[model samples]
Target: MRPEDVSALALLLPGVVEAAHQGHPDFRIGGRIFATLWVEEERVVLKLTPGDQEHLLAEAPDLFAPVPGAWGRRGWTNLDLWDADEAVLRDALLAAWRNVAPAALDGD
Candidate 1:
């Protein structure tokens, strides 16, 4: 997957929008960031639950990792675009979206 591919997939989720954040593009829902693209690094950051982050990291170390330090401990994760396909990216993105999405947006 590429940065554009990640952005495309992230925007596919309901109520999602892309915005600039600290020189990078971030995906958000209800004004809260769910994911961010690091174009030059070929990676994306997903705001996930600690459990979800652990599962993904344990399952695919090459594809997922904590963002490092305090943020990572709180469930911020880094995903390597080159190591993931659409299905994997989509699932991860959905999880991130849901993590921050409003209650009314749940279960859809």
Candidate 2:
């Protein structure tokens, strides 16, 4: 999927807002960042739980990878936008959104 596609899909989630972070576009829920777009690099950073990060890394290493260093070990992942499948990206976005969205807005 493309960067715009990723942005569009991310905004479809509940309470999601687009904002700038570190000179990059970021998606937030309940004011907490869940994803960041590194457009120039053709990658998106996702904040996921360590378990989810591990599963995705093992399952789709080509499309998803750790961000590097301590942040990566703490569940920050990098998604290769050009290689990402729309459906898989959508699922990952949802997982990331849910990771930081407040419980009341989680649609439990």
Candidate 3:
């Protein structure tokens, strides 16, 4: 997947918007960031539960890894766009979006 592909998929989620933060492109729902495009690193970061991060990392170490420091401990995962499978990436994005999305907006 490409950076544009990440942005496009993110926008497909309900109430998601693209915004710039700290020089990176971020995706948010209800004003909370759920994902970020780390352009310089050529990766996409997704906010996930630590367990989810661990599972993904274990399952696809080449495509997924922790973001490092406190953020990583808090479940921030960095995905290599060039290495990630589209289906897996979409699932991760949806999960992150749902995690941060307001209840009503999440339709849950």
Candidate 4:
């Protein structure tokens, strides 16, 4: 998948909005960023739980990794788009979106 593909998937989530953050495109739900497109890096970053980040990293190191520094410590992850699988990407996006999406939006 590419950055556009990631952006498109993120926009599909309910209440998701596209905005710029520090010059990069960020996807948010209720104003909380869930994903970002790091254009120069050619990577898509997702807001996941630390546990999920570890799991995904271990499961697919070639496609997923921690974003680095404080943000990463707080569950931010970078996905290598060129090696990412569509199904995995969709699942990852949903998980990230759900992390910030209101409970009602998630049917909870």
TM-score per prediction, in order, is: 0.96, 0.96, 0.94, 0.94
Per-candidate Cα lDDT values, in order, are 0.92, 0.93, 0.90, 0.89
Tens-place lDDT digits, model 1, residues 1-108: 999998888888889999989999999998999999999999999999999999999988989989989999999999999979888899999989999998887775
lDDT of 3 by residue, 49-75 (tens): 998898888989989989889999999
Stretches > 4 Å off in candidate 4: none
**Model 4, C-alpha of 72: deviation from truth (Å):** 1.1
* Two-way TM-score contest, 2 vs 4, winner: 2
Q: Higher TM-score: candidate 2 or 3?
A: 2
lDDT of 4 at 81: 86
Instruction: Sort all candidates by lDDT, best to worst.
Output: 2, 1, 3, 4
Pitting candidate 1 against candidate 3, the one with the higher TM-score is 1
Distance from true position, residue 58, model 1, in Å? 1.2
Instruction: Please give the RMSD to the true structure for each candidate, in Å.
Output: 1.0, 0.8, 1.0, 1.0
Error of 3 at 62 (Å): 1.2
